[model samples]
Target: MSRTLLAPRSWPLAVKVPLVVAALMAALGVLASWLVLANLADIQERNLRRLADVTLGTLAASLAAPVERRDIWETFDALDRLTATDSGMPAVAMVVLLPGGEVLAASDPRRFPTLRRLDEPLLRAALRAGDMLFDTSRARAVATYRLEEGGEQLGTLLAELDIGALLAERRRATVALVVSNSFLTLVMAGVGYALVRRMLGPLSRLAVAAERLERGEDPGELLEPPQGSREFRKLFGRFRAMARAVQERETILKRLAEEDRLAQLGRLASAMAHEVNNPLAGLLTVVDTLRRRGEDDGVRRHAVELLERGLLGIRNVVGAMLVAYKEDREAPGLTRRAIDDLRYLVQHEVARKRLELVWTNRLPPVLPVDGGAVRQALLNLLLNACGASPVGGKVVFEAVAEDGVCRFLIADQGPGLPADMAAILERSGPPTTPPGRGLGLWTAATLWQRIGGTIRVERVPGKGTRIRLAVPVRVRAEVV
Candidate 1:
């Protein structure tokens, strides 16, 4: 069995397309923002490291002179001024630790919300250790570290660069991100929505055209186009071409099918006319003979029987052909009267040909379908089976419902199908040659899909070939 997933009829491309695009865009924006945040933090860390190296170098050189306490202050203050005043990026917030771990001088001491002096564990570790550079968060951003000392290892000295400026940088980056993203999102959304809406118009028009075609009108007759797009017009053009090709193929096939039907009807008509003409002539002769010389009861009786049999044959032939050919163009339906009637019709035909008829009562009376089309499909199958049979051949039709689906099985002892016919019917083109048959298996498949059914073909081991059709059931109570 085959399963088909259909899009909901009420779904609107206008709303759906924009929403999907927006979600995708938003995800991209978040990823970009995270990268920017990480990169900005890295740049800030590098700037502070450069400042620490410069401050520590000058302090190390000053260590050669005999220590002057006041000059120590002056040395620290001057160096801080130099870095603070000319920092390409606000590089000022820094603190200097003396030999005894005292806060000798500073740059913006208040920038630190909570200041623990040189006594702090991280600061003490940096000052006590010999000259070294490291990273520590005196603040929520990157801060540089190094020992403040002269080359001659005096008591360890430490200085740390401040990180308050990084917050300002973060704010700036945020503002830029918001402004840039807002502008770009609006521009992209406007362009994307327009593109989507334009693309959708062609599909909508195609649907309308399909409906018109189903009603037996030429869709291309009016040929008004949908709003076109820069990229999608080509797509729609291809779609239109494909639709036209399908319609053309369908038209040709339909003409061929109709011609075949007509030819079959003609054969039946000729047979009936011939049969009726002979019986009428015989009846006329018998009546004339009776009129001339008193009727022979036995001869009259025989003539009457022949006349009745011939008339009955003509009636039966006409009735079958008429039922098979009648078209049902309105809404598809399942009629109780038709199913019961065809079952009997098929039984008689099979009996007349001396073929065995095997049937199972698994088919529910209530199945959603076109009763007439179903009958025609079955009739075609039975006709093929009967014609293919040698005297005393067997044919079987069975139905079973399982897993919320109906399976139809038809088997016959007819000549096993040719490879060519199997390929077209089963569409599993074998590596060998295919058989040619006048009946249209492709049409049967098309009709099956139209009514939400499926067809599969396979060979029955010793019985010849088997055809399987899976159709969905429709209940009358549900329709009511």
Candidate 2:
């Protein structure tokens, strides 16, 4: 399986933004529902209380004359009339009581039997004290009013209001609220998703464009000038400009690198001329000796051996120098043989400059390194060192492998390291110093970095500068 497939997918803004908005809407919806239901309940309770009080007042007035004459039939008829007129109210039953608290009559005789006196504290409070009483568990409300004739108090009328209708209406309202609120929440969720998705549309394109730029490909449509908000358009414009700048810089660097390679080749050509000339002279002399001594087998054999050795030496030098020029060469493991070959190529420079070249090779037989890159790196350093040294000045080149690291040190007896050279070793890329001053150093640094190596420069005021290139030893087999 691909690594990306195995990895968990990250939540995009498209999903996250909508989810956040939906959560907020849902929370607000719940809050609104609670408030609406609470208010509705309060209104229902108030209306129930009001209806009970009005019914009690009407019943008290109707029963006043009937109760004063103590007429049983008339009292029953008055109770019936009270309930009939209160059809719209939630009055379940009505009872007429005398001052002694005995029920004279009831609208529903079966429900509230006669001779049944409701002398409870709540009933008494409603009749003789408080305005009304309510029982929430039973969903009932009670109220009583005094029945009086002239200055004499006859009896009282008590009405029990059934709040079932209010409860039913509350249930219906809640259902309606739930249905309406849910639909609104869904609508809000859909609208929020579309708005958020549209708002973030440019972000995905920007990401793709950035990736394309990183891969050295044209950003194309992904980074096209955006429409809508000024900020978004400006942001995309900046991205396009940045990508163009990076591409331009990359092209310039590639050209500079190619030029540096050609310069190295030019230096190698000079070294090759000096190196090959001496071998050619020796080979020519051997051929002359072979022809003159053709009659003597022993002399001819010796001449032939000398000729072979001289030709081999010349070939070795030429081959060593050509290693750096090989096109698209793969780097091989570091070896003592490779280092010796590099030293051979630079021997001409040492001779031509007449500098005392102190050569030291203490590296292992084999180490993981790109042979071509390492050789080129060494060539740059040796050339730089040679150029810095005056005639008869000493130059030291040493290599040692210790503690699983290869250390190559080059020191030149010159004025000192230049300020630009110091900056080259201190940081990466083209040095801030003037052109032609730090290219070799920069190239050397670049080479070393490719092989996971570091370069350090140490300089004293009067003494010469010493550069140490340290590379961790990786075995060939361990390399990927």
Candidate 3:
């Protein structure tokens, strides 16, 4: 029961609320039934006792003369009149006794064949109406009264009431109580079920909406408008807001992922240009040597061999480029040559924009870093800075290595980061940029983070934006 109540998905609000209400109603019904039955029995017993007192008091008054005069015929005649007057009374037998405690006459001799001596308990217990002794378990009330005339004791009267009619009435009352309580429980259950279902209907719809959102389906109609109380409407509003936020985050992640892929492709192109250009330059040098000194066979043979090797190297570079597009390749560690190659590849873009590219490289050779990927990330940041800079504007590119970490910064002579971008950077989390901004910066941030690094954006002096890219050479432990 506890587990069921705790896991709301298993037992939804629609079912739980009604179950609770039904439980309360059932408890109330049991209590009410107990009280009703008990009170009814008490009332029946009190009414039976009152009837006995009244009937016995009147019979004793009429029997005083007959009992005192010791006339058996008159006493029996009065007993017959008493029974005939009210047949409904539980009066089965009547007897008259003398002051000496001797039974003088009995209305039914068979019921009291041994009534020569009257019962002393019944005689002693006749105090008042409320004090009448009644044996309710046996459905019997024996009332004994001392007959008197002008304060003089005449004789005694003993009446034995049957009490069967009172018992039957009590049984009927019990049946009626059972029927009424059963009806009330059913009514309560129906009303509770209806009210609970009505109250929680909106929540049910909200659950459906949430499930659809989880499945990446639009919750168009489900979140149209909320009904019911103000609290529920407010709750609906909050749910809609939360869902919208999740949707927006998902969109940002998708766009950032695509941008990252595009940035990698761009890197491959740049690296290919650098690789192919070197072999082409070598082939050109070999051709010039052969053209100038073709008379020497040895020189010609050496030049031909060098030319063939350079051409083969270019073929291998092109093949590697095709393979890189088809599958992932091992990442090479950063080196001076790789940095120089990247600088050479981006010179065309910088010259086209006529921007001053302040390239600073301060790092030892053979740094333990993913060269191609880091180059891509750095290239993206540099490209964005150059694009954002005005003509003849300076794009500062700086790189350094220290303490098993690489630090790279790119500052552009353009307006600082946009307001929205600044807000995103101020909130510390995984780097994310909204749509329609610079895809290059978004790609750089994602690539840096994927390699277990952090990216920070700063507003440089003179209305330019400075972006920092940091990557660890190797993971290390830290003391808590």
For model 3, the stretches where C-alpha displacement exceeds 4 angstroms are 1-10, 33-39, 66-77, 84-88, 96-104, 114-130, 133-137, 149-156, 227-234, 260-480
Question: Which has the better lDDT: candidate 2, or candidate 3?
Answer: 2
Q: Compared to the true structure, candidate 3 yields what TM-score?
A: 0.51
**Per-candidate local distance difference test:** 0.58, 0.77, 0.71
Clashing pairs in 1: 63-150, 148-157, 368-474, 419-434, 420-434, 420-435, 421-435
Highest TM-score: which candidate? 1
Of the candidates shown, which would achieve the greatest lDDT relative to the real structure? 2
For 229-250, candidate 2 gives per-residue lDDT tens digits of: 8989999888889988988975
Q: Candidate 3 lDDT, tens digit per residue, 183-242?
A: 777787778788888887888889899888765578888886565488888888899999
Q: What is the TM-score of each candidate against the true structure?
A: 0.60, 0.58, 0.51
lDDT-wise, the better of 1 and 3 is: 3
Clashing pairs in 2: 332-371
Candidate 3's displacement at residue 314, Å, is: 12
